[model samples]
Target: MLLLFVHSKAQTVTGRIVDSEKQSVVMATIALQTLDSINICATTADADGRFVLTADSIPLPFRLIVSSIGYETVMPECASYAVGDVVLATKTNVLGDVVVKSKRPILNVQGDRIVADASSIIKGRIVTCAFDVAKYVPGILCKNDNELSLAGTMSTTVLVNGKVWNGGSVLEYLKTLPAEKVSKVELLYNASPDMHVTGAVINVVLKDNKGRELTGQVKSSYYNNHHNTFQESGSLFYTTPKWSLYSMYTFADAKSISRSQYLSHHTVGNQVYDIDVDARTHSSSLTHAVYTNATYNVSDKSNVSLSYNASFSPKSDTKGRTTNSYFSNSNYTTSGNSYMHNLHLAYVLKQLRLDANYMSYSNDGTQDMNYEKYENPTAYSYWRKQTSDRFNFSADWGFPLWKTARFSLGATYAYSKTGNRQK
Candidate 1:
């Protein structure tokens, strides 16, 4: 008796997916189909846009289907062929004017806090800076682009990545943050004791840049509303496996004009008197702001960071004029220079955190006033200066006590000194 055995080698299909511009299309779907459009085997592209499909036997003259989001679907015929590079064309659809309006849920409850998706809130809205993101967060109020409140609470603290921001002028720090960098915002109404916060908190969680090496952005804007205002800002970020650095600088030159009128009626000793007053104010300022932070990863579960922030207003001037129906007029001019500096150091581990912050601020100004009462010329001049320094340190440790509960303990120390002089 003679026995014969047949040996067969499996068929393998390999290809790389890329867009028309030669950019790798990650996570694209690759499928092997029969001539009748029935799916046979499927695979997905990797980070490098490469895919492999193996089968015990592949039908001759088979079909290959490739598809990806935002790209047109493609199918190519293969007969004893090895697909090398598959270029997919982008898909674009044009339609007539169609109005489809829908509203997304403004807030969602997650665990112990309220969560707001920054991308959802920013979609279809014009958001220029991270401060703008706060405006859209539910239960948060942004006033004058500087003051922030939550649910009628004036004492609100803003944190970035679970760390306190003692930076000079929180507004300046927010301006340096780009809207795209914010992944989501978490609102903690009743913060944990370990947080060392007494009021409502808004924590902005920035997107991770794990695989990115270097990135930067620049922005400039100009507006004219009674006066000209110009602002320019630039930011840079560099990251490696162990070290990351971020820096930003902003400059602003702005001019503004305001007008107001006041009217009052007074009756004294059976005498009726009507008075009217009109006032106008003009102001201009030149400002420069800088912020930088450097972080180093000590291990998989530990890291350390240092940050510095400074804001300087070297030239600022304001002039105002007041006229009264009682035959009195007054004019005043004020000039000032202000600057602030903040430095912070932090060490973070999986279950422990330590922070130290120091800040110094100074403002010096002079005011000149001229007025005419009863046709008599009078002039007054005054100068004032104010300075303050603050230091704070805190430590916190947290651990899981139960499957659904956690225990945290913390301590904080703070000191501040302020001085004011007037002449």
Candidate 2:
């Protein structure tokens, strides 16, 4: 009698993970285990949610478990060489996992985004607004008074309550927004296509407050060097179930002194010539701006919003002096003013915006020069006037394709005309 011994060959299993909407779920953890609770193999899904795992020779009926952030877990039982798709539902709400008196982690990693618990992290800290709390966030830098960057990238957009913040300058608005109103802050490094923005963004989720309420803030700053700079601002908001209104005003008075030096060396026809010059400028300006916005909720799915913004620089004056080593010393002065206005309207996810801008500039000044090399003095005076009118119109609309995705299209038109005279 002849007896033959055969061994079973191990088989490979491949599958793809996706969300309920059939979108690929990347960075998901997939594990295979034996029926008796023995670990066999484990792997992670690639960008396309494809994974491959090998079954052992014993083939004891294994099961697969797939899990990802912000999604429900999936478990499928199979034998050998099970290849197909695994679907996961979104984790919108969990009743069994609720703990009312528990503290959330300061940092949580969601796919391509970091959710920070600003309320919990800023506890016991002197944070009056989000700007004050930004310094504590990881991988974020406040480069200047009005600039914020994520890691190394400088371009960043800010959103409040899941909607784009159309308020004035981000730095100015942040100063007036109360920190306590923030529930969480999401840092999105890899934004979705619907976001439109190409760089990192910060999304601030505000608390869900019902009923009517009023909130506002005031801010002022002063700086003194050779000249003095002053800034004052105020913001106010009133909210109700049907309508809400927000307004902000700012005033700035600034004076500055600048100095520059220039040097050049050139050769012409076997002759070398060198020139050195030093220049100094003194400037002062006054600016006033007002921004107001209002929204009326027509229904749960739609709303109407209107916004108006106006800015004016009453006076801007500049005085400059230049001293040249080989020629003359020149002095001059100039002054001008400018104004702008913008009006915006939106219906739900569609917006129509218009802007009317005007500027009137007049420079009545004199240039006096002393030619040191020639021992001669000369003077000249001139008057110049200029005015400009510009108008711009734009319309944008967004179509919701998925729960978290959208298709956006827009159009814009701008026109400007100017008139000038010189003497």
For each candidate, the alpha-carbon lDDT, in order, equals 0.79, 0.66
**Model 2 / residue 283 / CA error / Å:** 1.3
Candidate 2's displacement at residue 175, Å, is 1.8
TM-score of each: 0.70, 0.58
Residues 1-423 of candidate 2 have per-residue lDDT tens digits of: 999998877778888988889988776656566565444555567778888765544364667766664565666777656658899777665469873331222555544466677876577567888776554454455666566655433367776544444324656666667776678877765454444455567777765445698999898999875789999988888888887888889999999988899999878999988889999999999988787878787766667777776777778888888888877888777777766666666566333222222222332333333334456676666666666565544555666677634666766566777777777
Give model 2's TM-score versus the native structure.
Answer: 0.58
Best candidate (score: TM-score) = 1
Candidate 1: lDDT of 35?
80
Error of 2 at 268 (Å): 10
Cα lDDT, model 1, residue 244: 81
Off by over 4 Å in 1: 1-110, 117-134, 137-155
Encode model 1's per-residue lDDT on 1-423: one tens digit a residue.
Answer: 999999889789888989899888776656576686544555567788888877767887888767654576677888765788899887655557754332332444444456678887788778877878866664566787777765434377887887776645666667767788788887765566766776567888887656657767788979786899999989887888788899999999999999999999999999988999999999999999999999898987899999999999999999999999976799999999999999999999999999999999999999999888876889999999999999999999989877636888888999999999999
Backbone Cα, N, C clashes tallied per candidate: 0, 0
lDDT value, residue 11 of candidate 1: 86
* lDDT comparing candidate 1 with the true structure: 0.79
Candidate 2 Cα lDDT to native: 0.66
